[model samples]
Target: METANSTHTGSHAIKRQGPQQSHNHPLRKDFFDSLSYWLDSPSLAYSSWLSEQKLKDSTKTVYMAMFGRFCQWLNEQGRRLDQLEADDIRRFLDSANPNLPQSRKARTNSGRQRQQYVRQLEKVFAHLSSLGHSGTNPGRIAGYERIGTGSDKPTRFLNREETQRVIQLIQTELDELRQEEKSTDEWLKYRDIAMIGVMIGGGLKVSHIRRLTLNCMDMVEERIDLSQPGHAHRARLLAFAVPAVKAWLSVQEQMHGRKLEPTQKIFEADRSSGFGRNSKTVTLSASSIHRRTQRFLAMAGITGERASAQTLRNTYAGLLIDGGATDDHLVDYLGLQASVTAQRLRNAYARSQLRPAGGAHLSKDH
Candidate 1:
């Protein structure tokens, strides 16, 4: 029996494996036989179609896994791939059995997972239609309302006061580190302060922050050049300077015992990661940056699920829009691919601008 990982072959006669026997009792043999045939042949066509569309390998892998799972489920229902109707697809998504394992049950019940399954199956069926193997793509039926995950929430950003408080917290930490006499502590804190400044002041995504090198900044001009190759947005200038960032540069130069070179990563990891004068460049991972951001947010008494590097970015966007920058200007400034995202930020900014009555009275008396 050909396993899911079996090599692709042009032959239609290849034997395909069924679901594990322990779980196969519910499925009809004929359904498995049909599924095996489709998996061995039409699935190849689906793969080819995916490649033709220039999808990444990771996307292809995800879709293939989704197809395999769908086939297994279809066999359990005594249905062939070609026999599926829009109602059948909808029913499969709607029905959730408690007898299944926790993980499988969760996957089945998840609206997001169901949506992904529907999307992938749509592509697969479209490929089958293109090959004249199927006449209809059940996945595309109108009025087939997808299960709403209800997980999405509004993005959060710091207001001007909260933003200033966070900066003060970071500045205090940096000042403490400076007196510690430990070079490592000072260097690391400086890096942290610099990272926060770049995110809040420049509105750079985590990827952009990770790729920044020493040369990206122009101290004389008080602007950072983000026009590096492979950047998502066209190269643009962010016209703000964070004093903490410059302070970090000075500390970095002193720590290195020499002037830093332009080609080196701006936020390189510490010595524990083998970052040294003669070593190749190494930047902090996105996850690491996120964890650090959360930690700092907590330290600043800004407690919320949305206090993240992304929130800082949102804060930057909010500030820009509040300052009367248009959506087009924001798209260019943030290196966004579309004005829709900028528009969303603008809307969020507008909402944030609606202050409650007596909001100033709630502040601590100085």
Candidate 2:
């Protein structure tokens, strides 16, 4: 029977010692020939390095597979482990074959796979640096930090019925407030209605809404201009939302008992000391607006991870897409920095159209 001290040691056990050998080890170049050789045979040194990272078993397998491919590629390029530079790493990443190849021809790696490869290389180079084998972490300088997975969570938007229910609830409350005598508390409700109306009608971001001032709204033109110093959007037309906005302005004027200055913020927190002659006003914070919007959503029976003002803006964008607005129109209307973003939103809208109304799952019978 074989014993621990037997001369019949595993082939991998001998090759695995290459990674842990001295920096000037004679067999160092052979180790880079193909990490898969030792990995498939089960390397003690590679397993130890993966264990030191405290990674999951599945993650360790993925990392080892990617690292093995990289080592093989380096060997093909006649590149030594200690002589790597950032540019060489970048070239390899751009030219490397995809792990899951679709055809015989080598294909470029996906953004997600590229990110994973760079991350694995970063760990490898860092380990080598600690061992005094490599001078610099070329993986980090190869732009791992800048690369993204190129995937985003599906966008969340309300259906037509849900959107109308929320708007109806707001209009009902706004009507009730108009009938009641004006007060400081009532002004907040008016502001919330106007803020939500603009969000749904204009697709403005939370930051744009927060920084809005009296001068930003041209009620006569039924337009909201956001070309203010810090705002990103230029202007957005307000359709079907003019009444709520005008009502809020009237209520605000009466609450302050004077004409509102153009510079006064349109959405400010209700002051405990009534907004009378000399009361100081505080701007409504982003959280305050989110909470207000969330309450409206809860009242309308719409609840989810995305039950906030962003959902309202998303719904607004969906409306524009459904109305046959072009991609360029969306880019201008939504103030999106990239035209690709408009394309993605259009794709999302198309995907939403394929789903059952209100996002219901398909029945098994179908």
Residue pairs in clash, model 1: 227-235
lDDT over C-alpha atoms for residue 270 of model 1: 66
The lDDT of each candidate is: 0.59, 0.62
lDDT of 1 by residue, 28-128 (tens): 33332233345454454455555556778898787776565666667677766665655466556655544578877754446576677677677666645
- List clashing residue pairs in candidate 2: none
Cα RMSD (Å) between model 2 and the true structure? 20.6
Least accurate 10 contiguous residues by lDDT in model 2: 8-17
Candidate 1 stretches with Cα past 4 Å from truth are 1-62, 65-111, 114-150, 175-185, 228-241, 277-280, 355-366
